[model samples]
Target: MTEPTTHRTEVVVVGGGQAGLATSWHLVRDGVDHVVLEAHTLGHEWADTRWDNFTLVTPNWHCRLPGYEYDGPDPDGFMTRDEVVAWLAGYAPTFGPPVREHTRVTSLTERAEGGFRVEATGPDGPEVWEAGSVVVATGGYHVPIVPSWAPALDPSITQLHSADYRNAAQLPEGGVLVVGSGQSGAQIAEDLHLEGRTVHLALGDAPRVARFHRGRDCMTWLAEMGLYDTGVAQYPGGLAAREKTNHYVTGRDGGRDIDLRAFAAEGMRLYGMLEGGAGTELTFLPTLTAALDGADDVYRSICRDIDRYIDAQGIEAPPAAPYTAVWEPDTDPTSLDLAAAGISTVVWAIGYRPDYRWVGAGVFDGTGRPTHSRGVTALPGLYFLGLPWLHTWGSGRFLGIAADAEHVTGVITGRKGGARTEPAADLARRRSPGEIASDVALAG
Candidate 1:
């Protein structure tokens, strides 16, 4: 075969999502030459993967991508998947980087000459790039993780992962059992229930938080209290925190609050964590009360922070109403037979695990998790970004990616020993008149 098309760059940033784009912004600002290799068009996940009416769990104000922040009228509101995708698509051209869309990196090998050799396939066919450094900015949630017990279920019952689920009409005619009570699972269960389909949600230990507490957005209080600043080491759960699911909250109902108990109140069934399946029968752990208790604890924890913030800021605001509804699980029907309940569909929203198979070995741990200090991998010149809890709890989120990217860039450039510096001028140019006002709020 003919030799692969060869090219070279100072740095090769892989994946074109928010993480990669944020990294590119820092690199470009520092005057580094690089190429962004994307498997598909920019923000394809937000465009194609999410359902039609899917709204973000986080509000629009949290949509801070390095130089850009949400400046729409509803800054406190949540953005739909399409709106986010459109914004990202438009944001890509702002910096004018050399981005090669539709280029999928199939393999990444270290070169003896002290760099990386990236092999990818693009529209022009096989291509190769030699770079001094590589940044894998692929955000989390690449693969849908179905439990080991999934295959044991009877094949007659249809199954789909949350990634594949689009709308209620797509599923078969029957009750829907949605596994995992995280944000996605809870929202989907609510959607199905609203569509007149019977929905059953597998209870998880995800915490609950109100959309607005005490006349202030919950996120604002959390951010001010440095909640997102919590790192993996400092996390109360330690390693377990890395795998913990997000709180059960939704942006639907005009940005109103939603939680697992709210779903139960809306006439959906709630069950404990799925244990296993025997033919058409499914067994669940009897931890429903524990899950509800855990959520209550989280809510209380947040409320405590809100109370503290109010005291510190000296701003008079209405006290939040005490949240009292709790789901009382029925002790009788723990195990349910799918056929008997008329449940023909199962949606697995358990979570996701990253696949670094294409990258060289030894950079990841025995469990295939990357061992990195903030985004710096063990291997020199190989880095990681956008991983959950990589540097902090918000590292994987849009609002936090910029700081992480800036830190990684400092390490790469040896500037101020990996410390972050505010790029006010760069950010100001990217903001609209409306966005400038929001940016001011972000600074405060």
Candidate 2:
């Protein structure tokens, strides 16, 4: 085996997706010397893993990269999977930092004196990196999570996660029972249903929002209403929005509602949460009505906000419509038989959990979540970014990552007040002529 290569830097950023690249941008702006390590190519998940018909749940306006906003012709529209991939890839060259692609970090061991020692395997071979600071930007969606009893599924039924699902042609000829009623589950169910497949969607307590209201998108109104400004630490009405399920909406069909109730109205069978399965029998909880009620509550709350925004701004906009989609009680078996229902596949669209096994002990909580405050961990020089509620309601989103990154860079560089104060000479040294041109060419 070849000897491990070693490099040193002021900061080492793990993962080269939106979060990592965003962090790198601020670091470059501050003239901090750092390198980005990506397990695959930049935006690997978006470029290679997403389904063929996959589009963003958020619109193009929310697809902002650090220091760059979307200025394309369709600012009000949504970006397809390919557009998202290209957007992220195009972001990196603007800063022109050295991104070590195809490099997978195996371990992050904190040095006794200070800083961290990052070990990885790259194209050539094993490599070692020592850095003053380490930013774990691998993102929250690291691993796929299925129920504990997923292995007990029928031998013949094919199992896959939403991350692995591509299209209807990839599965066997039969109905599909999709578990989890989050955005992914609802969208996948819709995709399968649109392809003429009988789909049974297991419902959870997910909220629904109208695709658009009045003359603007729901998200735009939310931003105007200051809903996106609500941080997890102090949400309005003491609501723990972090624990709440993502609102059920879709970017498909130029932004549309894709709630479970709507799916039920379209002939797709709706079931409760997937409790467990033995052999070919799957058990569901009696939570169908409760889930619908929860969605209705969220929908009403959003309409209330829209009404308040209209009155507050004194804008002459049309009245918002009420949510009318209602769930029909199904007579289907609570405990379903796969053979009887002709379900030859199960798609688990449940959310992901973080795994810090590679990270040295003492940085994570009992629940495997990293212990941090606005990306700053207890250990000095160790930080985290891209978590669902790391700082705010939009923490994991593309639009919110830059603020978190700026905060973390502030923590790293000790610039805690007043103006940025970054010297003009530092910027001139870091950004080349082409990079300067590219940065200026982006949306201001």
Worst 10 residues of 2 by lDDT: 421-430
How large is the C-alpha RMSD of every model relative to the true structure? 4.2, 6.8
| 102-198 per-residue lDDT for model 2 (tens digits) | 9999999988878899999999999999999999998877789988888887789999999999999999999999888888888898899999999
lDDT of candidate 1 at residue 291, scale 0 to 100? 84
- Which regions of candidate 1 deviate over 4 angstroms? 237-240, 417-444
- TM-scores of the candidates are 0.91, 0.91
List the pairs of residues colliding in candidate 1.
none
Model 2 clashes, total count: 0
Full-model lDDT for every candidate: 0.80, 0.80
lDDT of 1 by residue, 154-199 (tens): 9998988999999999988999999987888878888888898999
